[model samples]
Target: MGLSPKSKRRLQRILPFGVIWFVIGLFVLFIQEAATGNKNINPNVVITLTPKVFVFAMISVTIIGLLVGAVEILWLGKLFNNKTFYKKIFYKLSFYTFFLVLTIIIVYPFAASIELGLSPLNELVLNKLSNFLISLDFLSTLGSIAVSLFVSLFYSEISYNVGDSVLMNFFTGKYHKPIQEKRIFLFCDMKSSTTIAEQLGHIEYFKLLKAYYSDFTNAIINHSGAVYQYVGDEIIISWKFEEGIKNNNWINCFLAMKQDLHKKANWYKNNFGLEPTFKSGFHVGEVTTGEIGTLKKEIIFTGDVLNTTARIQGLCNSHNVDILISEELIKELKPDNSLEVKSKGIAELKGKEQKMELFTVSRSS
Candidate 1:
């Protein structure tokens, strides 16, 4: 059977990094062994990553790493996406604790066995085998855990700092030179945000904001949209023009986020004593992409499209709808049998030269 769309997309994300790092790990081990002049490093005479042993070690580690990747993508990623700040800290600690212990107890030994078994059966190897210095030490376990944590934490930090759009832009200094591209921008703002803030007060209001944004994260990621910014209780979501048009993911994401938030209504009521809602406005147009600031660098998108999108979102109250879309975006949206769209006529949006036709979109069912 052919791969499902979701599976194919997931693999597309995983394959390149997986192969790249596997090669890097192999070379690092080879160089480390070659450069070590101190013979007393391990004292325990054993098989090392000599050409033949490097192949076996690399294969073993790569397979184990892939298994970890599977768990990370399929379970850990989804599990952590919508969690509160404290919950995320707790979950990551627990996961790392479990993985560190497992790596020491199981993964290391298995890898060692693979190296020894695959090594040439020469006298030196046979002698090393008899001596079999497979002694487990506290230092070894601690060092391995330290290395594992470093790699994991570094990767996590980088991923958190760079949003999907930044990654899609190839993450180079190239954007600093200025480039123009068409993108679908969605301005999603919390309904009655000021009132909600006043009701909850400052401290609790911050927590409420965190929880609300966390809940919508999965919908955005799954729908291939990237967060552009968060202003007050508003979040700016964006997709490449083509990315949004394909299967109408940009529109579907808002609907899916609403569904997700609805499912959490009871939790919100119990925790915050109120249910929060959001209104979204979407449009498609060219945005100038460039890096902004010197000390605190960031990718900035500037254009009329963003301003127009924000104004459209402000119209949600007048139209009595949760989502509003500009004619430009609506024209490109692929027809989805599950969704229905109605023309909301032309409206002179704030700070614009011309009246823009609008549409209110929602699930047909």
Candidate 2:
């Protein structure tokens, strides 16, 4: 899913904070090192600093931490359909790798320095270098490695929980349980999406489409809507009755989604001067819902309502409208003076004998 403006702003804000805090933490270590009067400090000391090593060590750690933090922020912004399972493993692997390298960079040098410090000044450096190649304690080193792994895992768990909490708050507006019957289905599709893909080539087109899908999916989720599927250019979104009623004021959600699209449009325009647009349709009806399929089960909606929604969306091309909805959906909506919805009158839809009323939503009501 795409990142909300708020979430994006939050990430921008936190990135600087992470950098600042990391620097501050290193400075604190530098102060401690200075007080201890350790002149020849080892860069391999796991989490310590001395006067001679503080500046370089601090810069290294801060840069690495900021890089990792930036990666986390980017990953958080990308909305994966199954984030929970994937993210858990991703965090563990990332933290384990980062801390393992950091520990090696810090501890090995410190151990060598300690051994050398006990010797004469001229022999100190030579002795430490020779001893580093030999007489290293395998058992103690193994224990240190185990401790580092455990610490890294524990730290990752704590950080993940904190990050998840912040992410949930930033992205989710409100939550309501799904109501049994009456609900609305909205489908939005990128026009000539395939044509763009063909022109851009598979790899380039996939990246662009992925970004578009991510943004749209996040918008639906943020608005407490369930994303059903992405069929090529089209995305199907479902809103249950109760949650729809609760979030009847969807102007904010729409604005957020539009802003996201605007960003993508600008990027594409800059690179290829191609502006992408979407056509959307909505319908409200009673539908039975439950999980379908045995091994690869998925939440499925049954009945003609979904099919009708697709038909309504298809009408957009002939009607020359970007967004259209059934009269049934209009009636269910709590009227807003800001929207100018034009009644298109009863129209005969293909494949269905009965006529259905439709409307077109424009900038001006």
Candidate 3:
């Protein structure tokens, strides 16, 4: 199968570190060789910082960066997910420090042997490695690595919290001034959330909400949906107009989420004594998008579409359906055999003067 958007995004996040380290390696090499005219103190070692040596160093450091980034994302991130900020930093630094030390122990011997044109087991090479490990050069390299690690980790944390696109927009000032853009929105709300909270109590219900929201991550990312907001039990996801319409990603995303939740029904039942379900309303329209606020800043969308979407979602129970879409958005969806859509006819939506034609959507078995 082809890679999902989520997988592609993960790879995108991981690869940049290697490229960055490759550049850093080049800069460091230039400073040491061309700028400072530094030379190796050990007479046994013959390899100087030539272009070939620089290339080797760049490739090696890039490989190290790839390995470190992969570990941070796949292993350490999940391991320290629930940890406090400072605690997570401390633990990650500790583990990576040890990892770097171990890497030096294994790689330095081979590297030194190559330079000396001798076996890694040679006494002369071993003696040089011993001196190098204790020398100021090793300490300096370690210090540089430490600084890079801290900065990268900080960037990753901020990116994760604010979202990649949002952070980029902030840096690029794309949304600094309010701009009009057509976008698609999916307003998804939990079914009978208040009743569930009452039954489970506040704390347990909070846990369920957490799990519920977490389960939607794969489906959202896989479909290229950006979560706009998390208002209690409801999550609003947004997509570019073309993105949502292409391959019917907007509807497919909802179906994927439904499938995922159903697949985990047993687990939910075992843990929470019940399984949670959600209803969503889809609408597409032009909205004013911009960065707003003084004390606490945020990128917000303001338009009638949002209100209409929420109203559509509110009608879910009245219609005894789990999904609803505006007539205009329905026209945008390509005809597909996998989905069955039925018109609910024109109706006066609450607090709105204009009548709207709505539709209920379901997966065709």
Candidate 4:
């Protein structure tokens, strides 16, 4: 799709990082021009540019790109995707600070040492400790920290809201055009949501919902499941045919999600005086995928599969089952020795005339 709301907001935040650097570069360029007379308005005083300037700029750009891109893609990507990591903002800030200093040290001071033979990697220089510390430009390191912090903070928030892959797919417009793709769908909903809401009240209840979904987000990302939508307390998760089927990610996602929440049960109970519980249903089928809407555009799926998955999850309460899967999906899944599947028989889902065969999936205690 063409710049969904979330994508636009994130881009807007990231754009400042680029703009700040561009403006600083321009300011430096102007200062260099005034100092060197590289572009005198008077025709008689035309100063030629030297290769040294080009060499310096190229080195700086290359060093900055390598250092920043390496950390961003490898470290930040993982940190942002893990919802639990946000709870540890101190660690995040510490890493950012350390990375900023380390990157600048390697990119400039340490690199300069290698070329100049002024440090340990080369020949030791006179007053080695003093010279090495003096060689480091604290001003430039601070600048790097300022820019990195802004970018990292913005990215962390966006990744929390959408996700790393979702942010990328949003910008790439991967689902902009409509196409039918076979996929696995898992509809997971909070159990006893009404009672929880009433007990916690509206404002505090929202916090509980947030914490519950955060756990779901972590599990979903861990299993490579893309979040299709969040309806009320229900989270709709999907995966491509290959991704969902291989390694049984579709199956594990629900189980893992349960475990993630269960681990947080005490926190919920202490904070909100209640433990959170949820149920899920899974199915696989073809769905029409496309970007829909304008003011608040979203990548969405439209097909009977989505409805069927929802209905299947609804059966969880009646059947007293935590997870249910359509028989169609079960055929493709090979249950491990510890995992077990029990036939729930045919279920005449809501708004559907056909009675669909269903099965309950569980793990051995």
> For candidate 4, what is the TM-score?
0.68
Best by lDDT: 3
Give the C-alpha miss distance for residue 353 in model 4, angstroms: 1.8
Give the alpha-carbon lDDT of every model.
0.74, 0.60, 0.85, 0.70
Of 1 and 4, the candidate ranking higher by TM-score:
1
Taking the tens digit of each residue's C-alpha lDDT, what string does model 2 give over 1-365?
77744466446534553455365545555555576675434432232334444555555445544555565445532333245755755655566465645554454454345444543244554444445434333343344434433343334444444443333333342222222477778888898887898888888877777777777745655665656677877887777766765546233344456667877887777765587778888888898765445575344677788889888988988888777788877776666666677887787778989898888764442
Q: Mind giving the per-residue lDDT tens digits that candidate 1 earns over 226-264? A: 888999999999888887887788988898899999999
**Per-model TM-score versus the true fold:** 0.79, 0.55, 0.89, 0.68
Kindly give the stretch of ten consecutive residues in candidate 2 with the minimal lDDT sum.
Answer: 170-179
What order do you get sorting by TM-score, best first?
A: 3, 1, 4, 2
Reference-based TM-score, model 1: 0.79
- Using TM-score as the measure, the top candidate is 3
Score residue 55 of candidate 3 by CA lDDT.
60
**For model 1, where is the 10-residue window of minimal lDDT?**
38-47
Between candidates 2 and 4, name the one with more favorable TM-score: 4
In model 3, which runs have C-alpha deviations exceeding 4 angstroms? 23-47, 106-127
lDDT string for model 4 (1-365, tens) is: 36533344445444534444444444555665787567535221121234553355445644453444445445664665555545545555666677666654454434444434456344342233234345433554365455545555655456556755666567778888888899999888888998888888999988888888878866676676888787888888889989888778888888889888999889988999988888889889999988888897777788999889989999998989889999899999866887888998889999999898999878877
Candidate 4 C-alpha error for residue 315, in Å: 1.2
Query: How far out, in Å, is residue 220 in model 1?
Result: 1.2
Off by over 4 Å in 4: 1-106, 109-159
Instruction: Answer with 1 or 2, whichever has the higher lDDT.
Output: 1
